[model samples]
Target: MAYKKETMESDCIKAILDNNLMFQEDIFSFVGFARSTYFDRSLDKSDAIKKALNDNRIKTKHTLKKKWEKSDNPTLQIALYKLICDDHEFNRLAGVKNDITSGGEPFDIEVFIVNGKNKTKKKD
Candidate 1:
């Protein structure tokens, strides 16, 4: 007996949706199917069955925002500035300066540098 492409796709989608697997590769492995087979039959459809299955998947918006906030660490930012000013040496010639302010302020930092004989103010 042979199953229609749509039926196979729905079955695959059911397996994928019910399983604990989060990644495409993991789902494919769990079902003992090839990537090509899984994607072509399911993920490749216009009304992609895989998309419907994973529709309720939680997004990592909070995690990413937290990481971004960490990356914007004031200490790290200042350290980078100091490193640039000390190591680059040319920053002085380029007239690069670090001016930072904090707390609900309009801007966190203001950088004044001479660019082609004109003073440029950069806000971060």
Candidate 2:
């Protein structure tokens, strides 16, 4: 299919000019540009248009985050938290230490079986 120019929002144009890492998918979706068209345009489109598509991605993310936070559903907030939080790396980044001391003294760690089941038993 032939590439066709699509009308993009004025804000989107400004977004591209302001940000260097705008999400192309958001720009394409917002401007009704096909993926193929986007790639093709990337090769020949004016530098200004290219920059706008790249920079608009941040605006897209900001918009989504606002919606996620505003939603009344609990899961939406959790989803927003996941989107913003780096919990997986929090422990290392926060300088957390992994040391376990029992009653400030050495303790015996034992394993036992009961009813054909095994479980850990800690003793002081």
Candidate 3:
């Protein structure tokens, strides 16, 4: 009763999307697989997801289509920015703006992801 790669991946994706937005490792565990296989499969999936995200960013920034819009509230805008900036691509592009030192301004966090995608701020 072995599952195929497509079945494994689809189950992994569903477990991820179905849960409370767990990490890659968490997703792998959910599907009862080892870390190695998860990492091997994740590399390609991560790349594809990131490429799609980049495309969305381009569309959001360059067109009047306005597929996505930030809230007008400074508080909400900053929160949304922090959420988007959590992505590695966004963090690097923004100089890791989300990282807070001991003596920096404080802000509220809304959504969080885990693993390399962890979005929670570490208390320094």
Candidate 4:
């Protein structure tokens, strides 16, 4: 069957957009479509689903932004800020990459033959 945009928007797509936590699987289950349909000959329908999902995400973000703007609660404000912004200090820390090199400090790792057998020694 061909992709029915109106029916999907009125039903499954509507439900998916209404729930922020609904994943692709949830949408497929709600729409009574198999997950495999997206990979087979129904790829176009899958693309439509993705576009609708993106639209819903934008709508959801806008709604959240409006609600966050109207609130006077400091904790709520912090939560929203944390959701949208990253800590500068943490970002700097995350960007620091530790390169493994033999240039920092000198250490003696040598094996010396003592008597007849080999012995490991460390420089003091």
The best candidate in terms of lDDT: 4
Candidate 2 error regions (>4 Å): 1-47, 89-124
Question: lDDT of each model, Cα atoms only?
Answer: 0.56, 0.59, 0.55, 0.62
User: 1-124 in candidate 2: lDDT tens per residue?
Assistant: 5544443334347545555435555554444456666666553355666666544666777888899899998888877776666755554544684546677677778976667854667787
C-alpha lDDT of residue 101 in model 3? 45
Candidate 1: misplaced stretches above 4 Å?
1-3, 40-42, 46-48, 59-124
Cα lDDT of model 1 by residue, 27-73, tens digit: 56555456676556555553655474456354343444455457868
Global Cα lDDT for candidate 3? 0.55
Candidate 2's displacement at residue 50, Å, is: 3.2
**Would you list the clashing residue pairs of candidate 2?**
16-52, 22-54, 23-57
TM-score: model 2 vs. ground truth: 0.36
Q: What is the lDDT of candidate 2?
A: 0.59
Clash count list over all predictions: 0, 3, 0, 0
Q: What digit string (tens of lDDT, one per residue) describes model 4 on residues 20-123? A: 53356666656655556544544435555667677877887888877886899877776676666655643554576454456866666897666885466878
Q: Which scores better on TM-score, 3 or 4?
A: 4
- Candidate 2, position 16, lDDT: 53
Candidate 3 to native Cα RMSD, angstroms: 15.8
TM-score of 1: 0.35
The residue ranges of model 3 lying beyond 4 angstroms of the native Cα positions read 1-3, 42-124
lDDT, residue 85, model 2: 67
Question: Which digits, one per residue and each the tens of the lDDT, describe model 3 over residues 63-100?
Answer: 52232344456655554565565467566656755666
Which structure among the candidates has the greatest TM-score?
A: 4
Candidate 1 has its poorest 10 consecutive residues by lDDT at 56-65
Indicate whether candidate 2 or candidate 3 has the larger lDDT: 2
